[model samples]
Structure formats: C-alpha cells, structure tokens
Target: MPDNFGRYFVNAIVAGLVGRIIGVVKTEYERAKVETAAKLKGIGIGVGLLVAAAAIGFFLLGVLITAAILGLATVWPAWLAALTVGGAMLLIILILAGIGASMIKKNKDLTPQQSIDNIKAALPLVD
Candidate 1:
C-alpha cells in the first residue's frame, strides 16, 4: 500500500506540472495574438501615412501649379516658377516618405519574439 501511494503521488505531481505548462502556453499564445494585432495596426498606419503623402503631393502640385505660375511669373520666369513649385513638392514628399519608412521599420517585427522566448524557456525539450 505504501508503494501504491508513492506511485500515485508522483503521477499527481507530473500531471500538475503538465497542466501548469499548458496554462502558461495558452496565456502566452493569447498575449502573442494581441501583440500581432497591435503590430498590424501600426503597419496599417504607416502605409496610410505613405499613401497620404503621395496623394497630398499630387494634389498640392496640381493646385499650386497655376497659382505659382501666376504669382511668381510676374517676379521670375514662368519656367522658374514651375521649377520652384516642383522642388518644394518633391521636398515635401521626401520628408513624409522618410517618416513613414521609419514607422514601417519600427513595427516590422510581426512575430512575438518575447513570447516565443518565454515559451521556449518553459519547455525543456523544445530546444
């Protein structure tokens, strides 16, 4: 009877350990899911910024072309006016693109690396 009790005790301990491991994994998985969602959201914002930059560039260039030509043509040559407006528009685009690129690079990690490391640490045979 003592041997039987000892066997059952060991089994209970192993079972409990397995259950705890499963619980940790489940919790980490959910955390990873939330992190992925946030990363995706950031990516979307970065893309939106890039698209807005292009759209604004084109719209402003088109709208300002006539005004710049009329306003600056009196002071400078028509060609020079157009050139100035084009350069300014290009500069605007570059600045916005740089900001958007930085954002994209920042959120580029879609995988939950920290969670993965935690899970790896918890599982001994997962190496």
Candidate 2:
C-alpha cells in the first residue's frame, strides 16, 4: 500500500509540472501572435498614409487643371495669361509629387513594422 501511494504521488507531481509547462508555452505563443499582429497593423497604417498623400496630390492636380481651363474661358485676356501660368505651376507640382512618390516607393527600409518595433523597444527603455 505504501509503494502504491508513492507511485500515485509521483504521477500527480509530474502531471502538474506538465500542465504548467503547457500553460506557459500557450501564453508565450499568444504574446508572440499579438506582437506580430501589431507590427502588421503598423505597416498597413504607414502604407495607407503614403497612399492617401499620393491620392490627395493627384486630386489637387485635377482640381487645378479644371480651374485653369475654366479661368481661360471666362476671364479677360490678362487673367487668361495668369491662369495659364497657374496651370504651369500646377504641372510643376504634379511633377514634384511624382518624384516624391517615386522616392517613397524606392525607400525599402521605411516600413510600418520597423516603426512599430522601434517604438515598442524605445518605450520599455524610456521608463
């Protein structure tokens, strides 16, 4: 009977240790998943912001073109010249925007995940 009791006690102890190990592994996996998700979200947000900026730049160019055309039709001769100049300025802006977009696209290292990781690493060190 004493031998049987000892065996049962050892089994219980092993079972408890296994359960704790499983619990710890599950917790670590969950933490890693959360961190990965946050990094992805940050990358998505950065891409979205850059795209939005490009979109706004394009929309402004369209508006400027429409105004330039309308002004050339309705305004006096002097104003028509000014409107043409404004159109030229709009063309320059569009060219600059294209260059800016190209630069942004070429920048491979500036990702949202990198930003998120930097912020996370910095925060722990700050306090």
Candidate 3:
C-alpha cells in the first residue's frame, strides 16, 4: 500500500510540473506571436514610407531640373547654375540619407530578442 501511495504521489508531482510547463509555453508562444505581428506591421509602415519618399524624391528631382534649366537660360551662365544646383541637391540628398540611416540604426532590432533569450534560458529547465 505504501509503495502504491508513493508512486501515486510522484505521478501527481510529475503531472503538476508538466501542466505548469505547458502553461508557460502557451503564454510565451502567444507573446511571441504578438511581437511578430507588431514587427510585421512596423516593417509594412517602413516600406510604405520608403515608397512615398521615393515618389517625392522623383518629383523633387523633376522640379529641381526645371529650375536649373531656367536659371541657366535666364539668371546665370550655364556651367555655374548647373554646378550650383547639382552641388546643392547632392548635399541635401546626402544629409537626408544620413538622417534616415541614423534613424534606422537606432531602431533596427525587429525581433523580440529579449524574449528569445528568456526562452532560451528557460529551455534547460523545461527539458
């Protein structure tokens, strides 16, 4: 009778531990799902912005080219206006590119790295 009781006691303990583990895994899975969804949403927004920026950039290039041509025909010599406009546009593009690079650098981690590490740490115990 004591042997049977001991076996049952160990079985209960094992079952409880398994249940707790399953609960933790479920919670973590849900959290990871939510994080992945948010990351995808952010990526979509970033791509949309990039497309919009490219469209605006093309429009600006057209306007600037028109301005350069007008300036060359009316106000300044051809070479001088072309050089000035080209240099200014190049500098502005470089500045804007730098700003965009910095912004991307600051928030580049799209993965839930902290959660991943936490799960890795917990995995041994689960095993």
Which candidate has the highest lDDT of all?
Answer: 1
- Count of clashing residue pairs in every prediction: 0, 0, 0
Candidate 2 structure quality by residue, lDDT tens digits, 14-112: 998778656655665566667656655555655665566566657666666766777777867655665566566666656655655555454444344
TM-score, each model? 0.77, 0.45, 0.68
**Candidate 1 residue-wise lDDT at 127:** 63
Give per-residue CA lDDT, model 3, range 14-116, as digits (tens): 9998887777677778777788777666555555555555665676687568767777678666646665666676566556555555555544666766566
Arranged by TM-score with the best first, the candidates are: 1, 3, 2
Return the number of clashes found in candidate 2.
0
Q: Model 3: which ten-residue window has the lowest total lDDT?
A: 98-107
lDDT against the true structure, per candidate, is: 0.84, 0.61, 0.67
lDDT of 1 at 30: 94
| lDDT ranking from best candidate downward | 1, 3, 2
Q: Give the Cα RMSD of candidate 3.
A: 4.1
Candidate 2, superposed: residue stretches over 4 Å from native: 59-127
Error of 1 at 114 (Å): 0.7
